[model samples]
Target: MVNGEFYRRYLNLPDPYGQQETSFTMLFEFREFEGKMYLKYQREEDTYNLFNKTTNAIILKQSFMKELFVNNVLPHQTHAPDATMNMNRSVEGQAKPYNEAFWKYYNAPVETARDSQILKALSEMESKP
Candidate 1:
């Protein structure tokens, strides 16, 4: 099981020295391509800080997990361009539009739990070393 403290440390909360806890929930979608992988995600904003725990920053969480999978878990030979760049280009392209719509439609609780499972699997892989 992943310790909650681990997540707190990983996020580097609002206060560096303060004991801040977070309660944000994140949903992730994963698909493996021929030689690369990508993550689809959504998360609550930093609303937890107002309380005691902090809500997860969706972009930060996504970037962190992406790096973890690439550097720690998935096997790859070299750095690849951000896959979303092609989709993000074009001042008036539909790719960006579609990307947002995809996440809007794809976000769900089932996928969220599945994403957590995948992270656990990756963590287990690290345990071997």
Candidate 2:
């Protein structure tokens, strides 16, 4: 099991130091596509500083466990892309619109939790009604 502390360190979040302990919650949506698992997620948490209140971020990750370990295809390489420039140009044009929409919809506020002093201050703020 991956703990909150692992994420804090991985994301380079600041330690709570002598102040209150920091807390984090992650929500993920898992999907299986073409025999691979994709995890789309968002994380929300209090800052290390008391005054900053809450912070959040989104992430996407793909897992190829079956292909790598079960199928033993890690050492094999797939066929190369077509050498046709027209094919590539058309695909790139089609992809741009899709990429733009995807990012705009999924975009959210993101910040590092590595500032201990700032987090400590945010933690001490009054709760909302």
Candidate 3:
């Protein structure tokens, strides 16, 4: 679970929509690609909501979310070269309209099943020294 103070800071972040906030609980998926671990954010119902509420609120583009994940969520972790390349390719090749890509990535079938997996992963991660 995210710290309450962090959540408060996230809620109060500046954005194009002003004091916008996310009522939905965010989910994450941890996967290994090309021998490197990657974490992908997911949200139920509204895919675009994730981008708007998180990325936009931080006044950064969607690509910057990777930095947030690496630095904050998985500090000291290093991604494989191919994993980074794949992520960059996917981002660059997103659908014409942003929403389409949002839905494709965040609203995809795998995302719907990620909540439980994320919880388990979080528990395991926290149990480590």
Listed in order, each prediction's TM-score against the native is: 0.21, 0.23, 0.21
**1-129, model 2: which lDDT tens digit per residue?**
156353332333354222232444445555565577654333333433222224332222222111111222222448764565233343335343356666885756655576666777677664433
Q: Best lDDT goes to which candidate?
A: 3
Q: Tell me which of candidates 1 and 3 scores higher on lDDT.
A: 3
RMSD of 3: 18.7
lDDT of 3 by residue, 16-119 (tens): 34342333344676767567767744433211122355344434322122211332344455764444334454443633555665576774555546788898
| Model 2: lowest-lDDT 10 consecutive positions | 62-71
Q: Name the top TM-score candidate.
A: 2
- Total backbone clashes of model 2? 16
- Quote the positional error of residue 60 for candidate 2 in Å: 32
Q: Mind giving the per-residue lDDT tens digits that candidate 1 earns over 25-121?
A: 4465566766666653433333222222334323322212211122233356488756764535432442334466668767465657889999999
Q: lDDT of each structure?
A: 0.45, 0.40, 0.45
